[model samples]
Target: MSGPAMFSRYEFMIAWRYLRARRSEGGVSVMTWISLIGIALGVMALIATLAVRAGFRAEFVDTVLGANAHSTVYMVPQRIENDLTDEVYVVAGRIQDYDGMAQKVADLPGVTRAAAVVRGQVMASAHDKSNVAEVYGIGKADLEAMPRIVDPATLRGDVAQFGPGIAIGAGIARELSVSVGDKIRLIAPEGARTAFGTTPRVNSYEIGFIFNSGRYDVDRTRIYMPLDEAQSYFNREGVADEIEVFVDDPEQVADWTLPLLRTVGEGAQVWTWRDASSSFLAALDMEDDVMFVILSVLVLIASMNITSGLVMLVKNKGRDIGILRTMGLTEGAVLRVFFLCGAFTGVLGTIIGVILGVMLALNVESIMAGLNALTDGGAWQPEVRGIYRLPAELRAWDIFRAVGLSLTLSFIVTIFPARRAARMNPVEALRYE
Candidate 1:
């Protein structure tokens, strides 16, 4: 404290004293603590919101990818009669020798599984209920090839033999008021031609299993049956519509494009999960980014409070600033003291807020459940398996972005008030005293 080396140390001490002062002692005012609280609240809100966003993103990706393929290989569209069923023909763009193609593509590097599938639309009815259905023409082999379609634990009934039975989604079962072992009728537009006219065909299939993927859309509309049965029913036999491919890492689906294209050759076009649902995926990414921007605005607002609080503080400390200047304190040191006073609020708040936010985000599910229980509202426990709980993920980048932006804004806000403090007039300050 006696030497020139003590200049910065004295500045810190003076700042600390100002921060710890009571109202009568000309110390930190209530407004300073209020500003700190505001900054902390803003930071906590940002981190928790980002964690929720990340959690939802992961849940959606997992749920969707479970029921759908990572990528699909399709050949040019073609119209042909599956069999000698009727006068009219079925239009199907199916890959020629798809089994061989699927096998070849499966042999490619990074390819985990490939299955030839036939897809068609129909109206299914049972137990006085009807709904539009998407029939996936997949056999035991295809089911074995793609494990994401159904979990062994959730699946019910026998599917080993297939035996003209359908594996239906749980939502569809509920809608039709039917479960495993119930018979459902599928109505196809294609039928045998007669002297009167062409008639629609109706085929009956027994429900073998009910699968719940937690995806409402898929559960309510999609059904799986043997490929051969589907081709025969749709009057399009001997060819499959497309080959669905699965890989090791779905996040890297984009990276597998070139290798997949080269392996399958030019006759067919390949579509990745990203390509098939570009708008949906884009919407998720954009939503995350949009939320980040919005929350950053809140932090900026909180930083403004820091500027305002410090400005009020500087006005109250004018005599102190003048006295320090006359005691050999440099203007630069005076400037630094006020800057530290403001910056300290932001730094401390950010640190405390980070701890609180992480704890909140990680236990969001429990918090939601507790709130629900307290309110007698069971909204947290949804009936659907996939959407039952809140998901929270605290990513490093998200934390860094939020904390860094907050600190930067706080640092920027402190400059004007600090500069004003340094330029105070000792004579004018003392005359009032």
Candidate 2:
């Protein structure tokens, strides 16, 4: 027989004998039951941790991509005269031809879509209330190309209802105690003092709609207006702060961004959404690493239980080991038998834990709903935080990692006991009995 077939036969026979012996026992002992439970708990912890981490990361990516553009183009500080004119359109048209630039970025190998966005900081006031917020100006047609940050049905008024009006974030509107159709005054800084004193410009607008992006920064402090209207208000006739681009494959960001930067020339800077939120991403990575290390301690503790249980098994099967030795069984074969028994315990526990973890991940939303129902709707709802329920993302790698770790720990626990069983003498074991 081939090597694989021969090994398979040997493993099957040894595992069968080990399992048969376990079944004929006077039921399972308290210690064995304890070991089984320990393994089960350990496996469950690993599965739950992996699922939660994957889910949170996936949801965070979705939330960010929904609220912000995938990439950005901006002029370096003090480079271009902030004046907007027909020449501005000429430069924009030329830049669009560069590789990886323009609304056609989605046509690139991995890009999904691209858009141009202009943003500025301004103070908005309505009636007696005033607050500083970021004003985002966008082309009405291009806005449709990006992810919908706000649901039209959720708004008190329609975004497209007013021509020169603006949309306010839900949180900001609530804080200001203003609603749709309310008049809002906009104050923006324009022009630099050239031998003159402070230069300031102010404009006014009416609130058109209220939108919620599920992110506190965006929802609480962001406002959107028509591109042309914003330019007129800011005294920036034809110039925009930046052009935003969206991609289909976020993983290929670096590959696409570099070529686009080269195409845009030395005057323009290109940035990815990852660069925009680097600190947040770093924090999430650190949190996952810390959580895994902490949870692995549970698995280590379970492994200790396995070690103790195997030590007891060695004592109980002393005579059996001696009889097998007298019947010409090799010491290695004897060791394999006990190892199979311990491995079986780990495999069974891992399988059960995986099933339970997957079920929990799939029904997390329903589970949260049940909890809310039980609590009589007293739970805090955070529309600004993106998702309401815990997210669970299961990957094949997570399962492989869990099973591989458990089996290795099980084998390690069986080592000493298996060695002791192989070394037992038939004469001494029979004499003791």
**Top lDDT: which candidate number?**
1
> How well is each residue in 1-433 modelled by candidate 2, as lDDT tens digits?
5223322456557655654435545233455566667777777778777877888778778767877887886756542343655242223322323223454444556666555556778887776888889988887766545454556555568757546678888878988889888878878776334468647667777888787665666777888888778766655566666767766677567677776666556777888889977887898899888877776677777867766766777777778778877876777777777777677776776677677767776776677678878887545255544454467888889878877777777778877877887777878988866
Residue-level error in angstroms, candidate 2, position 46: 1.5
- lDDT per prediction? 0.81, 0.70
Superposed Cα RMSD, model 1: 4.3
Weakest 10 consecutive residues, lDDT, candidate 1?
380-389
lDDT of 1 by residue, 1-433 (tens): 6546534787888888888857574435676777788889888999999998888778778876888889888876545654666555644466768789889888987888899888888889997789889999986877755444557876777666365578888878888888788899888776656798877889889998888775667878888988888888876678888989888898888887787788777766788888866887798799888988988888888888888878878888888888988988877888889998988988988887788789889998898888888977565544443454578989999899878988998889998899999998878877878
Show model 1 residue runs off by greater than 4 Å.
1-8, 25-28, 79-90, 145-148, 152-164, 191-198, 258-267, 366-390
TM-score of each: 0.86, 0.80
How displaced is residue 381 in candidate 2, in Å? Answer: 9.1
